[model samples]
Target: MLVTPVDNSEIVAALDAALDGGPAVLPLSADDPRAGELRVAMAPDEPTLPGTAVVVATSGSTGAPKGVELSAAALTASATATHARLGGQGQWLLTLPAHHIAGVQVIVRSLLAGTPPVLRGGQTFATAVASMTGPRRYTSLVPTQLLRLLDDPVGLEALCSLDAVLLGGAATPAPLLDGARAAGVRVSTTYGMSETAGGCVYDGKPLDGVRARLADGVIELSGPVLASGYRRDPGGTAAAFVDGWFRTTDLGLLAADGTLSVLGRADFMINTGGVKVAPAAVEAVLVAQPGVAEVCVVDLPDEEWGQLVAAAVVPVDPARPPSVAALRAAVRARLGGPATPKLVRFTDALPLQGPGKVNRKGVKDMLRGT
Candidate 1:
């Protein structure tokens, strides 16, 4: 299908429709003549960048869209990296929506694997897995999708059939990954964003031709998969790529074994009495408590402490809000003095934006009556 820029959205929708057992119309854009092929427009006067494929979107968590100029080489580099990491691609099962880089990578990797993936149309994970027609199969899922799969035994068994499953999009709660691994699922955690044309790190290690490093606590990446800067935004491009490295806002540490362990975003760190505390760390501990279903830790303004650690949690049972004291005690057991949350407020359900991620700004506003 020759998909013009105007038909990009239609192609994405049609792709999903095809996967869901609906009509498979090869969506073509006004400018393009064929199906399944997309041709994005460029200003005739402006010099085209090195890449053929240009993805325009912000990293969803940050809420700012910038055009990422990518070359076919860069995208192919990412796909090749993924193929090498996954021991050559098996039959891929599509679950995520098209248009996103991760979803796009699935299609490309399937092509690179010399076999089109089995399109599991509009079905749940179990239904999707049951529909595949290959020996060794693989799929990609976000943390939330993985959690939903874990909620049922049948779903768990279905996931176990996959030779490998790439888990990305957001942090995978350790407990959730542990449960999946215990239940016989090969879950490999990945890290990357749209700027890198999807994930470059797989299972804490950078794929071949990918570079992962930390500078001043900010996670930085380089090598083949990095986008050729933002489109028509010199300032944004310059800021995103400095000295040939894309410095991510995420802070992380390189373990002794050379694995990168992300430590949440640097801006999200809460300072209490001049001590820095990681909200993700706090929430990770809180959510492990017996009665907690979900938790979001935010920094609340405090004249004395500058910013106090406050948490808004969703309990498993409304009538069983964990006591503030008990919650504090639980957090303290894992984290020392400054890491404990000063305030614990229970909510019916934590405000969510995008699957599995609690909307920090929205949660703060909900607390402030904004």
Candidate 2:
């Protein structure tokens, strides 16, 4: 069957119907060019996912669009497990776009809990909260949105009143996480992706049935919540999933107690002078500096060292920004010389690709161009 794309309110309704055992739906941004690409990928074909409920597109920031096929059972399992982990099912607020897995899952979870999601629309968090009927309510957001909310007293207070705030879509900076918790926000930093139906791991621990393991430092996931496979790409699906386990590109460490600490993506490691450096680890150290508000660390081509670590920084105060020399000293003290950035360029903001994820590839080009 041909796939019809939907967005905004229609997506919520479509997802509700799908959760109630309707035909599969592939969501796409109303204005995004990838909608055509995704529709083509989901075109009528042999061996299609029988009970597939949603086909979500990957970030598409790197230029190609690929759909992750999610079966109804997988999507519902994720919703059930999330509700169990979060203490109970509650009304949800859809702040993210339905074209993304995060947004689609929000609709599924709300419907499964017998409540319609309250879309953020053009209203404040406080106003959104006022519209909610359930005493137990929750909202999902990315780290950047959480950072912005921290500056709004009313919004911060509104978030504080919620049962829990699920923060995901990207890594949360140490300062951001600490600040939110310090401000009385019940924030759970999530880990997982479109492949795992949004977040399978919450706050470094796997949810009810999701299993996280390490294959030579890379994270591998398995359980009922995993996606069926990629749509129209048998090769990609086979490469990512094998024997009921999905091989993740992210590198992680599973503590003896079963807590997983993600060590950034294996492809994200920057090689400088025969040494490998994890950008997340380096950013964690730099972000703690006084004036740095946000930072993105990437590798730049260097004739001398082959590849040099470079950073694009967004300062708390542009006029009184931390000097590159000072930033280097801070990293050198904590992460050693190889991990220290060779070049530091301060900027007003970091470019973003997907929901709250820092566009590292864009940052690298910006730093390298100058």
Candidate 3:
């Protein structure tokens, strides 16, 4: 069954059907045009795993959206491991779109807890969170949402009230995490994607039964929580899932204390004048600058450097934008000269793709036009 509506009743029904092992459920965003395309791609006689419970779409950094076939076992394992990691299952406040795995996990976790998640829509985050009841409370949000909540006193108070908050969908800035901690918010930074049935890692440590390893510089994950494979995309599946490990494009470092520090995606590396620079590393530095609200670092094609480091910055105060020279100087001082953004553009806001992820490709395209 294909479900697109964001309504609570619709989502609950879909979840129930999937858990009962009836028809597999495909949750699509109400506003996503790719939903139709994915349906067409699935066709009339698409083969799927017998135990498939949910097919989540992942378009990644580029290309057509591919349906990731997650089995009942995988979903249950994820939920169980999450609860174990979080101490116990609790009431979840559903704030994210249900189509995404993180959002779906909230409902699955709630179901496992023998309670219904408090549905939230159109209400201010503070009010919605304040309305939640039950002894143990939890919610998941992206960095964007966390940033907004931090700006609101009531929202920050509501956030602090929760037992735990799972922050994912994209890398959480260090400064943002530190600030959230300072506010007494129990923030757990998560790492994983649709293929892993949401986050399998909480705060850099793999959950129970989950194994994380570094193959060269790339991150590979293995365990019971992995998806069956990409639906009807064998070639894609083989490339990503190999030898019982899901090979992620992200590059990471395994610390001595067994913590994982994600550098960035290997594909996103900017090779300029013989030096390879991780955009994420540069972005972290840029985001720490005063008056910078958000930033996206991309590589602009250049004849001399192969690709020049460029940044699109959203200033906290549009009228008082930070100087390009000062920003470059900061980056150079912290990282190096090559890592400094050679081309800096100011924008009102950075373009977002899915669930608050900065559209790096889109930013690069915009810079190309300029």
Candidate 4:
């Protein structure tokens, strides 16, 4: 389903065809260079699972993209479990691009509820939220979207009108969540990826029939909602799935109360002078600082320390960027000296790879002026 230009009618049609057990629909981003590469990699006559529904391409920030083949049963299980957990099915407002799993799940859930989602393309979020009319309204968004919505009074009010707002796609800073909840936004922090068919865990608790376990600090998910495997990549599928559990690159801890706390991505860990630091931890602290709108932390090549902690910051006021010393002090107070950014570069905006995720690699290149 070549998802481009954000066409609601085309997305709905493709999703309907997939739900009916047609050829596995592979949704591609219009701007992604890898879209063409992925097309060539996939066999024209490749055979998928009998009920294969959708094949979502993983964001290839770390490496080559892999297509996650989700079956109709998996999609149904995900939608059913989500609705059951959210109290009941309701109208969903689709603000995210349809190529990603989060956006696709909204459509699936809306279809299950026998209603079309309020398509919010080419319209301000405030306008879209105001147009929604339903008894139980819900929408999923990334932390960045929620942050932007909070900046507008009308958007904030419109957000509060919903029964629930799911925040996912990236790790949300604690301060942001606190602020949203304080503003009465009914925010639910979610943890899951495309492999688990969107967010299987809401507010740290696994949804119905979904199981969360930690294997040496790595998160492993298992349930009916799990995707079959990566299309046309047996090795990638085998590496990610073992013993009926999908091993995620994210490192997390499952609490005694069964809540999950994601620390950060294992692959994203930075080694600095024999110490390992999770960039997300430092980013969380920096984002909470005053005058800081966005931040991306990366590991820059260094001669003395193997790799040094560096940060690319987007200040709220470009004319007066946040104090570098103050930013470092915040991280030092919260995460110690090793995690503190050795180099801080202020930018107009953090480079973005996808809809709402910060492009760490791109930020690193930008910092180097490459």
Q: What's the TM for model 1?
A: 0.83
TM-score-superior candidate, 2 or 4: 2
Clashing pairs in 3: none
Extract clashing residue pairs from model 2: none
Q: Write the per-residue lDDT of candidate 1 for residues 332-368, one digit (tens) a residue.
A: 8899889898878888876655434567888887766
Task: Mark the regions of model 1 whose C-alpha exceeds 4 Å error after superposition.
Answer: 1-48, 118-121, 317-321
TM-score of each: 0.83, 0.97, 0.96, 0.94
Per-residue lDDT over 94-139 for candidate 3, one digit per residue giving the tens place of the 0 to 100 score: 8887888898899999887887888887888888777777658999
**Candidate with better lDDT, 1 vs 3:** 3
lDDT of 4 by residue, 175-272 (tens): 78998999999989888888999999999899999999988999999999999998878898899988899998899988899999898899889999
* Candidate order by decreasing TM-score: 2, 3, 4, 1
How much lDDT does each candidate structure score?
0.73, 0.88, 0.86, 0.85
Off by more than 4 A, model 2: 44-47
- Candidate 3, residue 351: Cα displacement in angstroms equals 0.6
Model 1 Cα displacement at 70 (Å)? 2.2
State model 3's lDDT: 0.86
lDDT of 2 by residue, 191-275 (tens): 9999999999999999989999999999999999999898888899999999999999999999999999998989989889999
lDDT of model 4 at position 206? 97
88 in model 1: Cα distance from truth in Å? 1.6
